[model samples]
Target: MRLIAGATAALSAALTAVLLVPQPASAATQLIGNGAFTSSTTPWAAIGQTTVTAESGWMKVAVKQVVANPWDAMVAAPTTAALNPGKSYTLSFDAYSTTAFKARATVQYTATPSANQLLATDVQLTTESKRYSIPFTAATATDTAAEVTFQLGGSGGAPTVRFDNVSLLETQTTRPTALYVSPLSNPARWAGDPANDGDTAKAIAADIANEPIFEWFGGWFGDITKAVDDYVGAAQAQDKLPMLVAYNIPNRDACGGQSGGGAGDATGYHNWITEFAKAIGTRHAIVVLEPDAVAAAECVTKFGKDPEDQYRMLLDATQVLRAQAPNAWVYLDAANATWHAPDKMAPLLVKSGIANTRGFSVNVSNYFTTVDSETYSVAVNGYLSGTVGTKKYVIDTSRNGNGPYEDDTPGDNWCNPPGRKLGTPPIRQLSGAEYLFWVKVPGDSDGQCGISDEPAGTFDPDLAMALING
Candidate 1:
């Protein structure tokens, strides 16, 4: 029941949803030699009155507009080392101003470096210290070194800026061994809210600790961009790459008797995808686009909307995502091993921008074995052997470890398959697979498997234990 004035309730709900999900922390890679200023600023270039002794553990600068230096007032430093291209990097540091100084920091790149990009802005910094972070994707093919320039002083007058605990790190995002559980498909608030209780946290603690989690998207209504923005922020906070499932195809998950709904119509989906793309922005992500959108088109192939039409939709969606979030990688859903023939699926994938995406995923919500999925994927890859680019696929190892339940028919028992074990947790470069991800949250009931009375996507303890324990 919708409350009459539910803004307060809505806000509370939004806050609660974000809180249950914990962020994952990542390791840092250093590039600056004397970033901390422990020793004299040898590797770091300083002009005018920039010295290490001015502050306890920082480089204090009191510089003016000088001869050919051309900077308003700042201290600049170039990396004594080179940087790897095609990787995005972030630099963070603590800054304090003796007075009200508008501070800005610029980072420079290329083998022969000069000032190019500005990171931090001219905010009025007071005596109190504040942390500032800046990230840049190295698109330059020949960037050999990196440099940072800081404007410590205000434009109004000569400024004094001090920096400490400086760190530069590559945005270390690899495929998940088990990415931090994300709140995609509106999972039980934390990872996948299959249990629908606060106590699920008490239960998930043991396995989830090191279980690199991934998130899903594409099920919400209204402004989903806000949710994506929130989820991405949370993932970044934990240093995990947020993986999303773009499931809101115009008509998705048809004969499977699952959540077979989209935003509204085909036009409706286009609008939704537009916002979805904008929300992701330039943050790094791994997206599994439109699960079952292409594979299940036979269920909705009526009137004018044929399988080819669905293919067009998926192709357009990938283009939108690529144009909007350049760093984010896309993976189309290739259905499961049992669903489609490799030849049928391969051509569809190539048509739906497979070359543009990282790859496709399989067995997203089924009890299929990883070995079988890999075998099927290899056959499909063979079909498009020379056509697809880089050509790899991810498997839904979320629930395939002990293997599938003995089904009467190969088509039967995808929902809440009994005795299925949690498969391999998300791992990077898992030989045949790109990443073995928890695409389907383990504990959530799959459309009310007869044994359990819980709603779809809610936690089921019996199912959870079978998968978790195995």
Candidate 2:
């Protein structure tokens, strides 16, 4: 068995190799040899006498039951993460069916299909041409099979399905700005009398169109399980995925004071996240796991905290959270560029179980520009680099238009900078981020900034105004 704990030295060496050897500009590529079916169905095959035609830029399928045959399909070898293994990959294809009929899409272990070979057969398609990708853990990394296919049969009559851009892609890991991501989040508090310290809207503004939000479930709170369940339920009620910031590491915010400490210790955090995962249970959520946990952990010694124990929490947290929230997209927290260097942070990240999670998040509650965050992410991913390296990032762009404050004195600038404006609004797609989010509540207090009397976590109208208008 390849135990991750025992392989720390190897991971460190691999990380060193990643940094020393210059890598490529990108690692993502189309998994399908001929997904477009542009000129020929070279990689695809006609299943059980089914007919498939590769036309202009798409593939046309016609399947009919001849005798006792149940279904017919167009199958192709499936490389799970397509270009990269274990890269939060998703299956995507544009399809237009002639009639509103039920169609089956599945991953088979081999061209000669078997029951155990069937990976997923739950997706159903309609007549309209729409882009599709399952949000749940319908396709896992091990779902890699000999052939995945689209089937049209076992119906009243013959069915015709036309498909285009059929391919496997690393979910959330797109080139600079090529792929348009479709994952969603954001919630302006859906519980009882909560502080809108950073929330500009009183009621989450139902009239306003949808936008993604990321909430960090940090520090030690009451009933970890119940709290997360409520968060997940609330987000789903509003038709949004909860971007849960899993920020309860024991030595969290090691470099900052506004938010430090976790659920007592590593064992306490493991217990907390275990219950937190139990609460999440199959919810369609986006977990931005442990902001400042790893980056700041670099300073554990300064605070009399154990860095090894903190790393243990990160490793346990990733495995537990993902296993529990099967549908949730989990990202490890990598503080903004203003915080740690990529080389310094990369080893810490890999050591803290970055490879186990979906990717990482940067600029969370910090005043770095989106461009800077992207650049930082590219460098970090490079440090964890490989042709199929499975590391992606999310940027918190709630407020950064004016960039970071020009603080040189005590340099406590990040806490409510003087003239920072709102950064890019949360959207379904951002240039490099899996989801550009309003991670930190835009108007939240950054621990008084040495100027305002507003207590930490209290609503500050002035701070809100500055972010909204400055």
Candidate 3:
């Protein structure tokens, strides 16, 4: 329902359906010396109102007084190597407090009053020891005399803290193999709804709810950061890769269709996407960014706005996700196989920051066969061969079993086409595609077109049953 035969307005006013990690890196170079504290505390020191000792292979600190700030009482050690700007690093350590409290782990210059700080993160401590791994980029210039310190103060009461196996290392980005299966998916929720009982719920659970699907997010979200944090936190708890669709862009659905709302303007879009990326933080994720965004730029010209402005917005969004959510694998949407030729779409994607992303996504929220999408994606990759290098792609295999609705007119072919069945189930590295995802929820209505009169994005069980039966 997102794009028609061409990147133009729909025949009818069809409403488009709306839809961490911080794990340690492997094969990294340790940048901190004497991290295990096995021998003695030579370079380490207890800063204020505390006693530090190395014994039993762990550094123990006994706090003598409560302080106003965490930095008031700290256990600090100088780094063995310099930290370079723009390089990714991870700080991992095992720690526990005699009493439950909070502390700060900071990376800064060794000077008494450092001018710049590279990383400072708040950490919660419990009676039981647990390992914490934090990933961050060096935001400042090279610091040869930097130090890693643990600030244990401002807890309203003194508490003893222990640390072990502390290590700081330079790391690499690794994509996750397993996709997260959220229990919060639309179909999964529908299956559990009291109204949907017996066979309906069972069918949904078996055919759709069990599959991992991408969740769509946009400007409608009130607390965008919390929403993103909750979703990513859930995925991290399960040690799975979460998939998301970022659909909100200013002047979205510029075709003057039902799915027309977005952030108020370009600045609003940048701020919104920035917060979204920050919430994902260091967690691993797959983002299908702004479906139809690149393709629909052509329509923005009719609104008396430069299409280049839209491209710039998308490119900024890509940069934000790249810098803020380092572990996330982003795929800029390239519409579909039928919308634009590879030559036409290639340059658009390039201008829209495809180079900053993992790759591009095709056939999002649309009905297109996986084979056709693979062909189109391969062609686009060919055009981008020298410019963007070897880029990967994903296909939306939600509902294209019967292909396009040939019986209907070209204008209405994309909206709720009857006889359409669920395509291949979502899988990673399937048929040369990086991933095949249910980008479009299978049972959701496209608009008041073809067989469905429901509003866009509303669930229709009867329609879902038809697709499943086929």
Candidate with top TM-score is: 3
Residue 292 of model 3 has an lDDT of 88
Candidate 3 Cα deviation (angstroms), residue 275: 0.5
TM-score of each: 0.61, 0.57, 0.68
Clashes of 3: 0
Over the stretch 1-470, how does candidate 2's per-residue lDDT look in tens digits?
Answer: 00000000111221110112112233344456676777887767777746778877878877654323345444444553323233343455677777766666765445245543334554456676655443223233443454567766665666677887665543333222211111222223321235543254442332111344555565545545445654554444334456676777765666666665567777878887877775666545677887777766667788786787788889888889777667667888887774667888888888788877878888877776666677788888888885327576888877767766664553566666677787777654524676677777655566756445564545455666666677
- The residue ranges of model 1 lying beyond 4 angstroms of the native Cα positions read 1-178, 181-202, 208-210, 302-304
List per-candidate RMSD values in Å.
12.4, 15.4, 10.4
The whole-model lDDT of each prediction reads: 0.64, 0.60, 0.80
* Per-residue lDDT over 1-470 for candidate 1, one digit per residue giving the tens place of the 0 to 100 score: 00000000111221111112333456344666676776565565665544434356677776543223335456777765666666766565667776765666666673443443524445456677765545566655455566777755335555567777565556555532224445443333453444545565545544542454455456553447545655654565456677777778776666665565676676777777877776666657788888777677777755356777778878888888888777777888888776778888888888887777878888787766766777778878888786874477888887777666664554445666566687766666636777777877667776654456677656666667667767
Q: After superposing candidate 2, which stretches have Cα over 4 Å from the reference?
A: 1-211, 387-390
Candidate 3 per-residue lDDT, tens place, 1-470, comes to 45765322223332222121134323335667777888787678999878899879989998899888787888888888777777676676788899998899988766532565677889889898776666677765544467899999898889999998776765434555567777888788888888877798899889988887888899777767656765765565455678888888988877636577789889999999987887677768889999888998989887798899999999999999999898899999999988889999999999999999999999877777776777788889999997987688988989877666675367767778788889888876623687778988878887777778878777788778878987
Which has the greatest lDDT?
3
For model 3, what is the error of residue 301's alpha carbon versus the real structure, in angstroms, after optimal superposition?
Answer: 2.7
